[model samples]
Target: MNIRLLAFSFLISASCFSQGEPFRRVNEFYLKGDTRVIGNTILSEHATKVYVRPKGLNDRTEMVYIDIDADSETFSSSNASLDIPEGAKIKYAGLYWAATYPGAKGKQKTRGNRIVYDVKNKRDRPFDLVKLSFPGSNGYTQVQGEVIYDGMRDEIIELKNAAPYVCYSDITDLLVSKNAASGSFTLANVIALEGYMYGGSSAGWMLYLIYEDETEPLQYFTGYHGFSFIKPENTQELSFKNFRAVERGDVKTSVTLAALEGDLILHGDGVSVFKEDTEEYIPLKSRVRYANNFFNSSITINDQKYTDRIPANLNTLGFDLAQVQIPNKNNEVISNDAKQVKLQFKTESDRLFVFFSAFQTEISTDYYQRVVVEGKPDTIIKPAQEKIAEEIQQKETTSQENVQLYGKDGERIVNSRNAALAEMLKVPALRVPGMNSGYYVVNHVFSKRNYALKWKEKMQLKGFSPVRFVNPANNYHYIYLDYSKDPDALYERLLEYRKLKDLKEAWILKVNLD
Candidate 1:
């Protein structure tokens, strides 16, 4: 990839213009092959012609022309003029250039001698370097556009053909950092000699302003310059958007502020926080290595302050979920201020990698698994209820003169006791193969035949068609409530029995018949 690096800087050169002529001087930079460096030359010193080598002749030549008419007042271009707003801070200022000289046809030929210009006639000619005056020389500057040739290209201009276009340059950081931010400058040109036949032609240039507009909403500038990771060597305000705070126990793990998210895990004895932004202190026991040193910084948005309260690392940032407010007149964060929220946080951690991800805040928690066994039926649970029913039956059979044996009322009383005992018995289903239709719940399983038969007779008395299945492996008999072809109908009946008849432990069992 051909990464086009922008070359821009302020030129504080001595004047070359007349008393009232609007003059602009530019500091020069050259692209030697893939490398870019400041040229020892300036724009105003060349007498006749500015020269630059074409790519066809020398792969090591690229020349930069910067407009350095530094002033604090209003600046204008051919199309636009901007008055320096009151208290407005310039964030980025740039110049745009269009390469019209290396016409579409000029690019097809790789011949080195394609661009050649004769500087013999230096008066009233396009290639001649002459000075001119404009209306805005003193006050409201008329930022007219002019054209010239690349100094590096001129060195090999006779032997090479230049590139077809010159891309735009962004010198915002350089200009802003120096505090020599230029508000206005006359536009100039960087031209290449196409040849004797299609002599001297250059690229078109324009001026544009990128300033901190306080009246407008906040606009976020993203890039290496916009947001940066907090380090001891470097410190800057990081803009945040929709935010949330999450706490697990005494240690606050995560705080979602704006578009940034980071995790906090405190390990050592204790952490003390001293916020430079708010001048607040959190008591500490001792400081750990990575915890105490890294990410212990703060940023103030609005009236609220957020600092690294607990020891943690910033793992991720930049997943905008909600709008946050911009505090100052020159807004640091660019977003809607409608749902503005003030957040104060002091976080700390040992190992931290601050970045941006789609998932804002994620909690990593440990999970557990266990084996669960459903208990057996109460018929199996309470053996005493069955024993009591059997004892009553034995007493009725032995006492011939008892009213329980002779009278219809006595029979009804015995039947009611048997029904109550049957209701108490719970039938758990055992899965069986080939019983695809439907099968009943087996209330009890017995090792002996007599006990199974007795329960089967009791189930029959309880209005259920009981079935017996013998398990060959265990030599035990399984007593089921019924065997039905329709599983759904049997399941419905089972539900009703479980609800109304107190057969709560009842379950459907499938049986296989070969």
Candidate 2:
């Protein structure tokens, strides 16, 4: 009986060691001699200035020094706005912003670069590329390349029919290589690219390389997650183990990989050596090798820590699935959407990540699933979006009703008064020297504050108005008012407030006065 039991235990141990995800990834490499520095040949002719980027300890330290040409008065910092001219060397430190709303104050930059991207074209804000894969229920991404810097030399003076084409994200499968001499590169999942990309060990972010005829691979993993290439000498002494647990649905950090037929290994601090799931910590061998056909398998959670005990089949109850909502520019409402190109996950993404490509928001967290489960469709929000759209339409109708041609109120704000002005907006009557009119400023009148004088004063502290008007239907205010006949002044004054406000139901009325 004892001998039979011991044999059965060995079989179970063998089975346990074989169960887990298949190691289907490869290590990408970089070739020597590919980093190119812009030299003096271009500097004397079309070039204005150049940046001497220095190597770094942890991060890079780039020195930007620029000079303008005789034909260009639009130089860096030469304008009061410091709107740098084309080809001017500058460092993108990121954007700066302060909230005009109460209790809202922040400068977002844990991911990087929120600055207004300097560009001549109104349409093309640059974007990073990646390879997108549909992981069963939703889409997962593999980084294609590092940030592609759009240089000034790559611009055109003028074009015909170059209607502002927005730079949007799309899946790419370009041949990424390091040195184009040796054909030592592997086809990567996603390769960042411009026209001709040359990636190497440049002491920068070497994520992935696009493929060309003659290119090589560089470092496999940048800093995300991946297994290291194993040498034959270390195969004997190197330890192998199993059963390290992390969050269930978390993506395995590395994307660019080549699977060694059944011989896959995880390395670094991310090894399956010390398991970190909910249990008494049971450390495994620092590394593990696949036994037989056990390479491609799965680990079922026989038990769970923070939930009720059950028969051990996974379940998701009372969790919000359709939490993501994006602003519908046309409807004036936020809608649950995935990519218009994609089927699902677009709506959930607005709540998941702030501005995609790792720029996260404070409103909600990225979803963490221990197990992937597709739940019932969210029919609730379908009608909700329509209701909000109808409400917005009704509000627009109501606002137009308030539109009267100077009524007894003497140019009183139809929506009442809470106002502030943007740089685009200005005091209209202030444009004319001797214009005698009631140019009262109301501040952020539509703010939740009780439209009190004290609160208005506080609003004024933030460069807003204090005087009151019929507070707009939503959280908006009449920033400026002028019955002046100065067409250019009055017209320009209202331009700032002309953009659609959050309160789509509100309207600007030419108040009817007796």
Candidate 3:
């Protein structure tokens, strides 16, 4: 019996190690370059004054780097040769700049100027491009051969304090493969001076190049669930590890989730990684927090710290999925990537609800199994639903008796449609002693006099005393709910009636009150 047990344990261990795992690596390199004014350039032609700081100024020490007041200004910089690591090649590169001050709050009506860049390799000619123009760049003219900056911001002041906003331009595929070396670019800021407008930069320009030695195979797993009537003080645990990844080799895995955020009175929320058989929670290797807004809260995975509250209204929940890996002693995720994972939340109030639609990502060798929460015939909201049902049933019964119209003193009167038409036709015409005049406003206008009289009667039945004004020029009648001899007082009454009656097309009718 002991020998048989030992053999069975070896087989389990062998099966666990047989799963295939993919490898992925990411590297970031910064190339901080020098920014200096290139004299004798076209940018200086239309200048009231051009101010370009000396090259290689420390960003912290320098308050302002480049300040230009010219109608057009240009500055040039050369990026140094990249110190490529052995066996690693560049996948992509991004050029970045920071605009520190002279925000929209400044005297200038606009924030950043129409800027363009001239980027090129060491040997080839330059490519003229605009910086981050979106929705289409037809409004802005672009020079030939230059790649426009994809990342542009109209507002420079993003925070409460006057902080600099950074801009990035992707030049990865623009560069000629991994074999290509040095490159250079020139920044041209075209400022239209209405009354001496100038802009400043807070920091120098830099380049971030991402390199990868080898590409890893990617896999995706997705699932969706919507929890309803999740009262406060209830814990909701959703498991997303229904699917399995490739069962061969050890691999590193990270999960990404996108969910709709609804009203939830939850005090705490988090995710957990567990070993299915033993049911042990896996520890995280590290935790990174990002800058996010109220709706887009930052998320922490390891310690399970999450930011942002579930809003009462329907809002797009932009919580960053915390990236975590399989637990190991060396802090490397070498375990089988098929381990089960769950996202959990805790609520202290009885009015909390949480919802998730799906989780999708490109991890190497993953599988997905959908978990559905079946609808209960006896739902928690059956009471509220029953109440609405009762109200609707009552309305249907009362609708029959409601057919009888009543007058102001609660006496049964003729129904509106037939009675209104009959009474209106009895009146010969509108009686105005003098030239019809007053500060009058009309909710509706009609060319036919009979139509106007009928609408007036309809308004009376609804507890409003509407008057009709005749415009002899167009032979039209204007229906007015209120009027005054005092123009100001008439406007005040018109405003009040508009709100009380929910009038959208109401407007003051100008007429000669002779």
Candidate 4:
């Protein structure tokens, strides 16, 4: 094997044997590169819907296959619905499905007087493909998904008889092609183990939709997928950051979680959020969810229950899906200014496997802004020459005739016939090919020239008329409010700019032009 492959195999083997560590991060999706500065570039409002195929025979029994498609003899199907707001643009859509498959059926073995089933003798098969039918479609379309996590390899040793696996598919293009955002969708042929197993058998699917609306506030949306087995001895915690919340507005933050193998009758499992100030973990609860039994197989958002799926069971036997708003009127757990938060999942008796989690929260408008120049529409004119003239005129009006004046760097200069101050006010021309070493008060950086120009125009509209940008060897355009050779002056200017609420994150960039 190759060197990288050998290393990965060793790591997996070591993790399987480790008794203390039970949770692992398998995959993460988020905004990357300079696009992160746009704030709302990847930010959007989102909605989550879930349904289960092969639902339980009863509230207490294990999961069983109940095919919703009566006409199809070979396919097993289930259905769910999607409700999106009118006129909202869909940004991304991801479909996720997970199941515990212990292989095909066979005759039971006679051990002494008892009939013992040998699950190890069965062949292992992981399903990486499923069929999806859009609303009003006549037939099912095959969707090939990438495996996010598969525990089948560790089944006999670690996961027992429940060889759980999760798969994810980016269905954004497929949804966009249909131009239908809200309708009944069907999923079929999800291969999973039925009948009885060591742990309870379960299978289900969930759809996450992220959309953009002009009326909605800018918000950060992030999703993570992995297979983590949580039991009485082990707990899972996920930390989120890189987004700031609005302090004054009606801040709304929510989280969606999906898991399998949680029994309906079992208790002593809950989810909590870590509060930094009090150094305590606050248990999350809703109208249907309790602090002790948070993962009891229910589909709920905020305090409202969702009953728009085929065979919508109050108790899903082993599947659980929940979306709850944080710091609601009843539960004031998190603050508005919290930049980071950690979610912890724990269970005292039940053994559950968590696969997917997503978070969404409103952000400050200062994260991104477009400055419109006063009285100028659709264009930005250079104010460098005008600003220079204005500065010289102001100095001449404020000082005594022929009096010595000081530059921004505290250098004294004699005002010889009003020419000294004008010379001092002239802007320096930087060399294109040579290094122009200086300190810059940068507000933003963009990889594209067009984005930099647009930002510069916006800054000009906001009365920062002398805003300048420079392109160095790194090829990224650095937009700055001021530039100076003196480090002290640059530091002072940076402090002043940072005082503005919108520019609190503004910083200094030391460019070694040489």
Clashes of each: 44, 51, 15, 3
lDDT of 1 by residue, 134-221 (tens): 2234433122233322222333342123222223345555445545432333333333222221322222233333455446322222
User: Which one wins on lDDT?
Assistant: 4
How do the residues 450-500 of candidate 2 rate in per-residue lDDT, one tens digit apiece? 444334333323223223444333434343322333333333334433332
Model 4 score (lDDT): 0.55
Query: Which residues of candidate 3, in runs, are more than 4 Å off?
Result: 1-91, 103-166, 177-335, 338-362, 366-514
Q: For candidate 3, lDDT tens digit of each residue in 373-487?
A: 2322211122322343465456557865566777799888864334422442343333344545555567888988667766665554344546676766567787876555665
Pick out the ten consecutive residues of candidate 3 with the lowest summed lDDT. 1-10
lDDT measured at residue 323 in model 3 versus the true structure, 0 to 100: 29
- Position 115, candidate 4: lDDT: 53
Tell me which of candidates 3 and 4 scores higher on TM-score.
Answer: 4
Candidate 2 structure lDDT: 0.19
Q: Which has the higher lDDT value, candidate number 3 or candidate number 4?
A: 4
User: With candidate 1 superimposed using the best TM-score fit, by how many Å does residue 33's alpha carbon deviate from the native?
Assistant: 38
Model 1 has an lDDT value of: 0.29
- The candidate scoring highest on TM-score is 4
- Decoy 3 TM-score against native: 0.24
List TM-score per model, in order. 0.20, 0.15, 0.24, 0.60
TM-score of 4: 0.60
Which ten-residue region of model 4 has the weakest summed lDDT?
1-10
